[model samples]
Each structure stands twice: as structure tokens, then as C-alpha cells.
Target: MYRNLQLLRSIRYSYSPPKASVLLDVSNCIQGLKQKLQELNELKVATARKIADYDPMPKLEVKMQEEGFVIKVLSQRSCQGLLVFILEAFEELGLDVLQARVSCADSFTLEALGNKISIS
Candidate 1:
């Protein structure tokens, strides 16, 4: 009885090493992350090039009010698609876009109203 019990205690669970599969999975995840980071870097470079074309530069002002918030952006006429950029940035910050108004002439003015959320 003692001999049989000793043999059962020394039994091999599996021939395959568990760490080998885990290491391979981690390596694949790392490769995927690297590809994603490369794409983001390329996007950053493209955005930088587009922004470099502005002449008078871009200005941003934010006013936090009791009701909500108001954001004002001033930029050269050459600067385009700033509204879309502003919307994206606001959404990223978990803000809700209430209304938007734009004025155009010698310079461009973008006024956006938004409400902030309590992120807890």
C-alpha cells in the first residue's frame, strides 16, 4: 500500500511545459501592440505636418460655467477641419457637445458648448 501511494505522488501531469505556450502567447500580444504603436506614430507625424501649415497659429479658450462650459477657438483661415478635431477631443474627455457655431471672415472662430460628466 505504501509503495503504490509513493508512485502516484511522483506521477508527471503532462509532458508539455506550460511556460512554453504562455511565452508564445505573450510574444504575439507584444507584436500586435508594436504594430498599433507604429500606426499611431505615423498618425501623429501626419497631424503635425498639417498643423505646421497654420500661419497666425491657433488659440483656444475655455470657460467653465455653472450651467456648462464654453470653448472658443481662433485660427487662421488656412487652418481647416479644426471643428472636427475639437469634437473628437471633447468626446475623448467624456464631454457632451450641446451646440456649435462658426464664424468666418479674415479669421475663423469656432464656438462650442459642452457639458462635462462626472467620471467616478
Candidate 2:
């Protein structure tokens, strides 16, 4: 057809594949960007599967108190340096520790109690 000849002429002059033609450069579809996207997708899927294999942990709940605050931290197993972080946060706020208690059970539950008073 005359249209096919015009498309061929455009391809020849521009050194690009004709959009209306059945011929296509395979390299254009599987370029470096495609390879990188495939790798990224694979990595994301693997990380998600690995994360799903772990047990789900509960979030921390803090209740305001007249003295300071009562914190109830629910975790599947142990507190991963959370108690230390809590103490450091209280210290950063210039709160002096009045009393503290940490209780653990065979059910792999950890409860930390901290009673702090503001020096100021």
C-alpha cells in the first residue's frame, strides 16, 4: 500500500522503527531500564515474603497519668532495646526516674514500668 511505502520512507530517513509496521526492535522493549525494573520487582517481592515469615508484633499504647504516664508495650517476644529508648526519651525531657520495674513471663511477654518526675 501507499501508506506502507510512506512508513518505510519515514523509517529509512529517521533511522527509527515505524510505529505502524509489524517490525520492531526487540532491544527497545528489553532495554537497561526494563532489566533494572525486573530486578527491583524481584527484590521487593523477596523482601515482602521474608517479612511475612516473621510473627506480627503489636504496637505500644501510652496512657497519660497524673504522675507521668503509663506505657503498655505489646510485642510478640521481647523488647528490642525499647526500654532503653524509653529511658533515654524520658531523660531527654529532663524527667528524673523515681521507680522502675520490668516483668517478663514464660509466654514471651515483656512489661516495663517507669515512674518519672519532672525536675523543673
Candidate 3:
């Protein structure tokens, strides 16, 4: 009968929850941090993919004509003094603008037909 009581007591103790330890707590915290780091890495990769797929460079096309050259510039972004910078470049190149169209509302666009200026 005493042996039976000891067996029952042992069974009860075995069924009880284990005591928490510092090592276990640290291991759990490390696991949680690892999961959070994985999530952050995934988010970073997704953002980088979006940025890689986007192209912000401006588009420029120049066609040579019989009398002059046709220049077309387009961009999804705008910068202050961009038009003035381009006009300065044209002046430096000594090109006389024959016809031109410009739009800077939301995007920036410039279509120009120009020819080299004759020096007398």
C-alpha cells in the first residue's frame, strides 16, 4: 500500500508543469527575435523589388532631319530649372530653335526642332 502511494505521488509530480528556467527563457526570446528578423528581411526584399522595377530615368530621342534636328525629352519626374539648364546647353551648342513645345504641369516634356546657327 505504501509503494502504491509513492507511485501515485510520483505520477502527480510528473503531471505537473515543469519549472521555468533562465536558459529556456533566453532560448524563447532568441527564437522570437529570429522570427521578427525574418519578417523584416522579407519586407526589405519586397521593397527592394518594387524599387528595382521602377525606372525614373528620363527618355530622350533625337532625330536628324534634312534641315535640322528634332529633339524630344520626356520624364516622369520634374526638377527645378531643368528647362533653363537644357536651354543653356542649347545655347552653348549654338543651336537656333526653330520650333518648340514645352509642358511642365505634372511631368516634364520638351519637343524642339533646331538647327546649328550660321556664324558670319
Candidate 1 matches the true fold with a TM-score of 0.47
Off by over 4 Å in 3: 1-53
On residues 57-95, what C-alpha lDDT tens digit does candidate 3 reach at each position?
Answer: 889999999999999999877878989998999999999
- Residue 38's lDDT within candidate 2 is 93
Candidate 2 structure quality by residue, lDDT tens digits, 31-60: 766999999999999999978866766556
Candidates ranked by TM-score: 3, 1, 2
| Model 1 clash number | 0
Q: What TM-score goes with each of the models?
A: 0.47, 0.36, 0.56
Clashes of each: 0, 0, 0
* TM-score pick, better of 2 and 3: 3
Runs of candidate 1 with Cα error greater than 4 angstroms are 1-55, 104-106, 118-120
Provide the lowest-lDDT 10-residue window in model 2: 103-112
Clash pairs (backbone) in predicted model 2: none
TM-score-better candidate, 1 vs 2: 1
lDDT of 3: 0.81
